[model samples]
Target: MTSTHADAHILVSMTYASRANPNVSATDFNEILQQAQINNAANSITGMLTFNKDYFLQTIEGPRAQINRLLYILISDERHHDLQIIDTRELKHREWAKWSMNYASPTEENAAIYLKYSTTIGFNPYLLNAESAHGLMNELSAQKG
Candidate 1:
């Protein structure tokens, strides 16, 4: 079954990646995540966020209005730059039904997972295509559980 919002016919999912702004600190990222959790829960959004010190790869699923608002906020947020949208599609169901905002940090333990989808020596999400990025998020989310 499909869920509808006033602004959209059905639920949708969006994936995007961005480079962390140089001035953003760990504390800043923490604050961002906290705020996202609160806002996303209130808006009935679910997603996963994968980030390291360098970049952020995220996939959010929800009503189109809420997703559009979040994308605008992300574009305006100073903590990240060069936002690259990987994909957006209507969803019959959410991929992240259980998470308001699941978080993952790619480290040595998950280097192989990153490499499986990454073209660079490290976790550079900019090099990933839509399918690879989605696959990476699915793998990370499974590992997270």
Candidate 2:
């Protein structure tokens, strides 16, 4: 169920994880986000990425085919490892329509939200169930971009 502008398909939402690159600096992540923003905006993609010290959990939504392609690229990237998709579904509409790629990195100010929805205060998505993971993503999506 791929999509083009004219032959539009269902919105595909996916969540995936990878090991955080230990050496990558904040500047590097900002560069990555900058690139993501440009690419997502061009492709009409909307999603959020949550990064703690050890893992990354991201949920992306866009055309089915475009999502497929992006997944392929993500899997092939060497910056991280243990990459796996936790959820994928067809959506009638996008959940994060205003976001190109909203990055929600862990911080003291934002720790409470993660603590509330996550299994524990450590807030690791890798240990979360599909429902919890998606619930956390939904909460993140509602935040101001």
Candidate 3:
């Protein structure tokens, strides 16, 4: 969903390096997303996660208290680190209907997009700059052919 200035939304974007666990495969990541959906559904929170080879970028928005609580858990979890809060403005409804964690394999094309936006905005796609993060999401969404 498109966010407007009038909406009350808090956009927290963060990225971190993957843990050095050999068993953390694609299936494990998928399971995390599944669990996130179940957990967030219970709390009325919605968000999305995007990951590449060694980085993760996610956004969660909902009631301030609920989102903050979830984020605390997420940040403290052993799975990720170097967390950065991108934007925490007020937004209306969620941009995604369900909690989804999407995986994107790094390619020249994807890397190029990340580099371009990172250079221009001073925030890596792995981190969070609203414009760059949203742009990368749009790019990935458009490529779901």
Clash numbers, per candidate? 0, 0, 5
Candidate 3 deviates by what RMSD? 6.8
Evaluation by lDDT, superior candidate among 1 and 2: 1
lDDT of 1: 0.87
* Residue 126 C-alpha lDDT in model 1: 88
Which residue pairs clash in candidate 2? none
Cα lDDT tens digits, model 3, 2-92, are 3233423444333333332444577767777788877877766666676754456776666666666777787786655667666565665
Best to worst by lDDT, what's the order? 1, 2, 3
Model number with the top TM-score: 1
Candidate 2 CA-lDDT value? 0.78
Question: Against the hidden reference, what TM-scores do the models get?
Answer: 0.91, 0.86, 0.67
What does candidate 2's lDDT look like per residue over 1-145, in tens digits? 4346653567889988778778767776787788889999988788888877677898889987788888888887666678888888889988778789987876666667788766655767777766888777766656533
Clash pairs, candidate 1, are: none
